[model samples]
Target chain A: AQTVTQSQPEMSVQEAETVTLSCTYDTSENNYYLFWYKQPPSRQMILVIRQEAYKQQNATENRFSVNFQKAAKSFSLKISDSQLGDTAMYFCAFMTHTGANSKLTFGKGITLSVRP
Target chain B: EPEVTQTPSHQVTQMGQEVILRCVPISNHLYFYWYRQILGQKVEFLVSFYNNEISEKSEIFDDQFSVERPDGSNFTLKIRSTKLEDSAMYFCASRGTSGGETQYFGPGTRLLVL
Candidate 1:
């Protein structure tokens, strides 16, 4: 079974500052996908970013990027120039490259607060 | 971009009653999934549907729970004899055929069993 771990339960970042949420996973499969999801107070799960295990190159989307260390089994999300809207619960997820049958295994999630 | 959608933002039901949560996946997506998050817990996968059948399910998906894609756009999760533990936020997600396509999720439905 695959397990995702988010070591930080809560983190606060000053406005326009940078914050990184830590994540690690336990898996034996060499081929898989990792993801970061954000859930605001509205409770919508929004895809923040994704990284394919086969691709060593990190993935970035605007202010959100990931540092994926496949060999170390670590995938951390970095939010740069954070804004107030960045306050939310961030989840780290893992899924094998099982085509369409794969299901996501998620972490307990970290609550991020972007302070004004 | 098209988005997944779920109905009834909130529902309250008595214990032992049956509850059905509905979702409308992306029009062209072929794979669908259901997940739940209890208060302060991780989101857990319940089941996945592909080609009108269950492709994968977690151990938490017991006999009391079932899923059906009765029509082209609607995917539903039914819980029989709802217990207090069943109260949680239920989210529906869908994915395109591509191997690495990210699963798009809908705004979850909050179910409360009292």
Candidate 2:
């Protein structure tokens, strides 16, 4: 069984600043996929970015990027030029590369507040 | 941009009552999933369906819970007898055929069992 852990309960960042949310996972599989999802006040789960374990270049989606360390079993999300809209609960998820039948294992999530 | 849709945004039902939550996944999606989150908790996977059958389900998905795709577009989750602990936000998700394709989620149905 795979488990995701987000050690932080909450994070606060100033508008136009940067914030990084850390996460670690326990998995025996050599290759898998990781993702970051943002849930705003509207309670909608929106995909932020994804990283495949085989890719060491990391993943970047505009202002959102990730630091994926396969050896250390850690994946961290970095939000640059954070806006007030970034305030929400962010979840880190894990899924194996086991074709199409994979299910996401999610962390407890961390509430991020962007102070204006 | 196609997206998943769930009916009855919020529902309040009494204990021991039967409740069915509905979802309409993306038209081109072949895989569907159901997940739930208790307030202040992590999102928990319940079940995943493909080719008209459940491919994977978590331990949290018990005999009391069942899933179906009665028609071509509609996917539903039925709880035979709801308990107070069943209260949570249920999310419906669907994924495309590509292995790397991300799962698109619905706005979620907030179920409050009293």
Per-model chain A TM? 0.97, 0.97
The TM-scores, one per candidate, come to 0.98, 0.97
For model 1, the stretches where C-alpha displacement exceeds 4 angstroms are none
The TM-score obtained by chain A of candidate 1 when compared with the true chain A: 0.97
Candidate 2, number of clashes: 0
Cα displacement (Å) at residue B98, model 2:
2.4
* Over 4 Å off, model 2: A98-100
In angstroms, the error of model 2 at A110 is 0.5
Task: Give the per-residue lDDT of model 2 (tens digit) for A1-116.
Answer: 89999999999999999999999999999988899999998888999999989888999999999999999999999999999999999999999844446899999999999999
True contacts kept of each: 0.80, 0.71
- Write down the C-alpha DockQ for each prediction: 0.79, 0.72
Kindly report the docking quality category of candidate 2.
medium
DockQ of 1: 0.79
